[model samples]
Target: MHEVSIMQDMLQLAEENLRKSGCTEIRRISLRVGLLSGVVPEALSFAFDVLKSGTSAANATLEIESSPSLFSCGACGTESWYESLRFECPECHGILILQKGGTDLELTQMEVSSTD
Candidate 1:
């Protein structure tokens, strides 16, 4: 799947950052995945597991933080969280638009061991 490519990119970035910091071992890779990011967490994890072989992140744990999809009412400026594709304003029954968060895949932090 595409998650394999995504994990490869993430591992590349992690390795580059770790090398720059003089770190040789990665402990964890923390990611924030939005509900609408179109990236499946389980698939991503499986990709990482399969792709980490012989890399610095082979032993690294992949930590994913799930973000909920949020929408704002166009007519009333109200915000609501939903899990499905339907978007309806609960406050004023107005059309809901995506205001903040969701549809994002971000690497928040990486825990590594620097060997001096």
Candidate 2:
């Protein structure tokens, strides 16, 4: 699954940051995942669990925050959020345009500890 590769990349980045900061233990890794990002959260979590062994993030906890798909009406200026993709506005029957909120998978935060 692609989640394996994605988790690998995330761990690499986290490890790089941890090393730069002289931290040997990764405590937590937080991610913002959009509904439309085409990523399955369960799969990603399983991937993280499997891939973290023997790495700097072996003991890290993965936190996923889900972002909903947002749409704005071009005619009525109505904004709405949905768990699924939407193309039409419920009010005024106006055409809805996609807004920037979903469709992104981002690593938001990471907590690390230095092993003094």
Candidate 3:
């Protein structure tokens, strides 16, 4: 599954950031996953279970934040929630511009312990 690769990459990046930040141990990884980001938390968690072995984030908790999809009309500049696949704006029949809420896979914060 793609989640496996996603986890592998996320772990690798987390390890680097943790090292850069001088964290000896990580307690949790906070991620902001957009609804349209095309990622499944369950699958990612499963991947993390195996991929985190012997790594800095080993056994670390994964916290996911849900982000909703927002859209703006290009013609009328009207903004609203985009819950459907159809991008047509309800007001002006304009093309919907997907806003920044969804389609993001960002690493928001990390909880780590000092190396001591």
Candidate 4:
């Protein structure tokens, strides 16, 4: 249930911002979930459904971007995209992979509107 906890935290933060801005509703929430973020999209969606109950984001749509895992090989100094390919550089066949991206779970944007 890490997704539940994560969703709760995301909702709380958004709620705080909305409260401060005097917003009454949220139209959308956008996020970026990397391939290696260890978070399942289906599970996160479900968790959001459960956690959004009675919250400002209750009816908001979750816009998620599935980012692919990328890494740079130190041995060959090449950037490569490794989607569950054993973490090795395809060009150089190096065992060491310096992760460059696709390991982040971030809240990218939010849409808020006032009841006025």
Question: TM-scores across all candidates?
Answer: 0.80, 0.81, 0.72, 0.77
Q: Number of the top candidate by lDDT?
A: 2
| lDDT of candidate 3 over 1-116, digit per residue (tens) | 99898878788778888889877888898887777878987888888888888988885899887667888899999988754444888898999888767787878888888757
**Which ranking of candidates, highest TM-score first?**
2, 1, 4, 3
Supply every candidate's count of residue pairs whose N, Cα or C atoms clash at under 3 angstroms: 0, 0, 0, 0
lDDT of 1 by residue, 1-116 (tens): 98989889889989998989887899899988888888999999999999998998989999998877778888998887765554677777889998667887888899999555
lDDT of 4 by residue, 17-44 (tens): 7898788998788888887788887888
**Which portions of model 1 miss their true places by more than 4 Å?**
74-77, 81-95
- Candidate 2 clashes between residue pairs 3 or more apart in a chain or in different chains: none
Please give, for residues 20-83, the per-residue lDDT of candidate 2 as tens digits.
9887899999988897788999999999999999998898999998888778999999999876
lDDT of 4: 0.80
For lDDT, candidate 1 versus 3, the one ahead is 1
Candidate 2, residue 86: lDDT = 80
**RMSD in Å for candidate 3, one decimal?**
3.7
Candidate 2 residue 83 Cα shift, in angstroms, is 5.0
Model 3: residue 57 alpha-carbon error in angstroms? 1.0
**Candidate 2 structure, TM-score to reference:** 0.81
Question: Candidate 4 — worst ten consecutive residues by lDDT sum?
Answer: 80-89
TM accuracy, model 4: 0.77
lDDT of each candidate versus the true structure: 0.86, 0.89, 0.81, 0.80
Candidate 2, residue 32: CA error in Å?
0.9
